[model samples]
Target: MDDKSATFVVEGEGCEEDVLKWYYHGRSGRPNKNSGELSSKVKKYLSIKGWVFRYALKNGKKELQYQSPHGEVYNSLRMACKSYIDQGLGEGRMGNVDPKQPKKRKCLSIENQPLLKSVQSESPERRNKLKKQENRVVKTSKRVREGPVSSRNPRTVLSLLIDNNVVPMLGNVYYRNKTGPPLMKGRITRDGIQCHCCSKVFTLTAFEDHAGSTNHRPAANIILDDGTGRSLSDCQRQVSDSMKSTTTTLRTRSVVEIPKTVKAANSIRDENDGVCSACCGGGDLICCDYCPSSFHMKCIGLKEVPDGDWFCPYCCCGICGIGYVRDRSFRSCHQCELKFHGDCLNSKKPSEMKTEKNTLLLCSQNCERIFYGLQKLTGKPILVGNNLTWTLLTPDHRAHGGHGMKSSAKKENQCKLRAALEVMHECFEPSESVETGRDLIEDVIFGQVSKLKRLNFRGFYTVILEENGDLVSVATLRVYDNKVAEMPLVATRFKHRRRGMCRVLVDELEKNLVKLGVEKLVLPAVSTTLETWTNNFGFSCIPDDERSKLVQYSLLEFQGTITCQKLLK
Candidate 1:
């Protein structure tokens, strides 16, 4: 019977009777309404007692709702276990299997092998049917080959596909969407593998692989008219543009010329005792551009041409900076404002000149301005370019935020830019020395006056003005880290004073500090010189109480003022 019919029949039967019923209210054929209710109560009581039911009330509303059959079985087992536990009953050695453990399927024995084989074997009819299916596949493939083919050969088919709308071209072979300008064509192609537009070679696979080469597509598209497809006028225009771009001369492109070393030695040698031929009056000989004569510019009408480039009287020196000269050869002392022959200046030939923008031709001393200028402009902590050294002087802003300057009343404060001397004094030698060179004077120098004597030594630079040329002031700085950098020592010669050399020195040092990501500068000085921080320079001071004990003694006593400025440039 169907499930619905079964449910109706089950519902018609009242629950089996239990002993000691109180009511006989219903007719004899009919079940007492309380009978079903009583049975439900008994079942609930059995549940509390943990007794399992052999059968469920199938026709009950609860039973009609669907639930997992496995869950129902597990519930019945759980109830049985609980009832046994409550009753203190034991079913010893029952071999109750673990519900979680699956039953293993039995394996076939050797005796059953032949029977299994007979069952697996296919009949002859089944084999014949399989053969017929394979034959059908072969026939279908044969019919496909018998179909008509296109008129074009394989190579021609591919070409037409590329030419017509059959297939697409990739990369530099064609322009992008026919927009922009065309690429150059007729580029020297060594073989079919080489690209005519970009002058690059590729394998056949590479060409086929990328399909759209950036190098060739633009050129191809230019040849093929936009939207019109390969128009003759478009091809002509593309060819013209390609020729123009390739042919135009680049400004910095190389030009054929003799090497500098070969030309300088041979061409400038004078036949007449290495004397200049152009400017006849000569003590030391300098070469001329047009001829091979070596004559001194001083002996001739052009004694000292400031910032000028000239050919030697020998006509060997070129108007351009390019030229060759002998060892110990002197073109002219640019700072000296006079031409000095190699023999006279006792100088070695300078390094070959290379042209670049912002290039300075001055000796180390003369280039000080350039170095400091660049430092200020770029905000770089240290300016080290073209053999010049620059460092910036910095004040500590952290410790000296808002303090006023205080100086001793007894001493007249000399506002002479002398701290650069203080720097040089400490940088090179100890604070106490017999005497400092006049060239060491800070704040008043231009170029190197000590000649090239100390070129091998590396040090901070100071320039001094001299009667002959410019003086060179050199010193070293001691570096220390105290939150920010501290410049403990710097030295300059006495003669170089008043040229703003100290400011330049300070500028260079500060540049170094800032470069290291140091924002504060610390230095020690006497309280009497507090105005140097307040009036001359800007730096704020912190109270002694606020300073770290480690550096409190080292901190300067000067009143501080905070000055806003770019330290490195």
Candidate 2:
């Protein structure tokens, strides 16, 4: 039998009795404003009690709708689980779930049942089917004050059912057929509630003060249309209008981008560096219609200027799946290889969580957590073979009480920092003086220096390669959103030279860099070692034009060094 028929049979015992009771009186059946929320404990308890169907709200995402394992969605856990059992999709296990990123929730007091902000779901046709069956089961309990509720946004809208008409109810008050019972009688459903009225359905445009001037159906529910001419009648206003409306709005639609364009006279702006993303050179450049990236006519192979707006190959917004059209702003994440509009990100995430949005290395909380996870692995030895060990260090490692470090561990980290400082000073002395050179090393390592100098080393990481637990080589590095990285200093203990220790150190650093999405590694190769770098190392000299673009990085440079780069991917 169909689910509707089975539900109405009143089987008088066991599971069927439980389902009937819930259908008649549970939180979802006769909702009093819980915003379709179910407590986590209740969900788990239902699952432990052998309710096979389940739904989960995933974290660190802006996507709509909580979905079950079999891809079904519903308003509550008990109802969803029961539906799955009825449909026979097989049972599911609550295996491993990633910890949810903490977020502040806004709530409303009900004077009855308090409600959190609604979880997203669609009013599937199953709801309508159940509602129709429910009209037969509980005719007296099915009726409620019907109208176009202004305060409640609903998932399913009430519209004329004949010929698939989409226009909705127009007025604030509604009535059922007085003769007896209307045919397409609305009722409570397994998913949500539904209600209907006798007349005044419309196929024209606008809501509230709007006249039916056009046959336009708005993409949003803002404009409810009215085909019937009766705007004024003796309809009494319902007091339920002041209460929170249980109505669902349209099935969730993608956040739309209506690009705020510059005036026609001032279409393209020079806000980004006037250079090609391909060659990183300045010239007569073609700007992306959406983002700040520009490409030169030759570099992009455009023989003629396009007649309309042009977006770069990288103009797609990861959040919306929409490519840049005209005047839209977009930024790409180095880690996820995803592009997002600044406004789209702002709409989903809280404004206080600025680190992920501001940094290219991470575009979401999941990525932010990943980077921190990688950081935690630092200051710990990673073994390579029996003899070699790789260790990473940051300012936090050497800082007192860092991430709640004990005093002894803090002292140990300080000792290691000082030892690495001695080795750096031994290998690369300053052109000016020994003390000045040592000061630069100490400042970069400990972050006790000029703000501008510290900015270059904002996220400074020290890579060390140890042979049999002896520090052999070290490199000082910084990465910017996986776009590019700069290693200002590379040094090997004099005794450890010619043993390929520096190469091993570099290889290890590159492996981690790839994981972090660093695309290229640029080094300021001192003239004495330039040939060795270009030949022994896999680096090529950066052209003068390309070198100019590197100015934005504010990379550290010395008088005798020529810049060299090695692509990571």
Candidate 1 RMSD computed on C-alpha atoms after optimal superposition onto the true structure? 45.3
Give the per-residue lDDT digits (tens) of candidate 1, residues 1-569.
12442111112121111111211122123556666665554344334333344333454533322112233332332243333322322323213222222111111111100101121244543322111111111000000011111111111111222343422444223323334443333221212123565556442323323335453232233333234465222333343344346534321231224356534432323322132222112233433333333333333444433232344322222122233343224354222122344343334333222223222223323223333332243212233433233422211110011121122100101111122333333222221100111232231211112221111111222221111111123333322221333332233333334555556656655654455444455543334334655457554454433333212112111112111222232
RMSD of each: 45.3, 34.0
Kindly list the per-residue Cα lDDT of model 2 for residues 146-185, writing each as its tens digit. 1111111111122111112222232322222224432222
Score candidate 1 by lDDT: 0.29
Q: Using TM-score as the measure, which candidate wins?
A: 2
**Each model's TM-score?**
0.19, 0.37
Worst 10 residues of 1 by lDDT: 135-144
